[model samples]
Target: MHELSITQSILDYSLSEAKKHGGVKIREIRLLLGPFSGIVPECIQMYMDLLAEGTIAQGVKIKATTLPLKVRCRDCGKESEITRRHIACPFCESLRLEILSSNDFIIDSLEVDTDGD
Candidate 1:
């Protein structure tokens, strides 16, 4: 499953960051999900949790944010939120639409803390 790869990437990157900072314990991960991104949040969380065992990410919390699909209609010259995945534009009723946003998956931020000193 690609989710494994994604989770691995996240861990690999985060681990590097932690190591760079002398092994800080990650507290929470804030992620931004794109509407068109194929990665499922639940699947990611489940796999990440399992993969994080014994790692710096152990006990780390994951927070996912939903991203609404946005499209620009050529006919109506308007931008609107798309609920469904298709060329269907509700406001303009036109097939001529350009996707403005969607299909974006990124790790926004990671909170890590070292031993309380």
Candidate 2:
């Protein structure tokens, strides 16, 4: 579903970056995936397989690293890591918390072949 459009964007960005770096082939893409970002790595790989055909981005391996969920307590203003099941702030025992991480998907880096083929 949403992974389709997101994967397309990833491919587009990868191609753009590869071209900028004078790369002839994109070998791999490193991704930082948030735990609660709702993005499935398998889905993205499937979409990328379809979308990257005939492009320099084809045959690209996606390496996704899941990030931990961290939140800041509104009362104590302290950041702590917590699981998705339990969201309460550990320091102040307050229900009000501001999410600091685990809600975003980011492209970290790319491995590309710069040699002329």
- Best-matching candidate per lDDT: 2
lDDT of 2 by residue, 1-117 (tens): 899999999999999999998999998999998878889898988889889999998889888998878889999999998776777888778988888874578999999999774
Give lDDT tens digits, candidate 1, residues 11-84. 88888887787766988877888776777878878988999999889977878887778889989889887765
The C-alpha stretches of model 2 lying farther than 4 A from their native spots are none
For residue 10, what is the lDDT in candidate 1?
84
Q: What TM-score does each of the candidates earn?
A: 0.78, 0.88
CA-only RMSD, every prediction: 2.5, 2.0
Return the TM-score for candidate 1, rounded to 2 decimals: 0.78
RMSD of 1: 2.5
- Stretches > 4 Å off in candidate 1: 21-23, 85-90, 115-117
The lDDT for every candidate, in the order shown, is: 0.81, 0.88
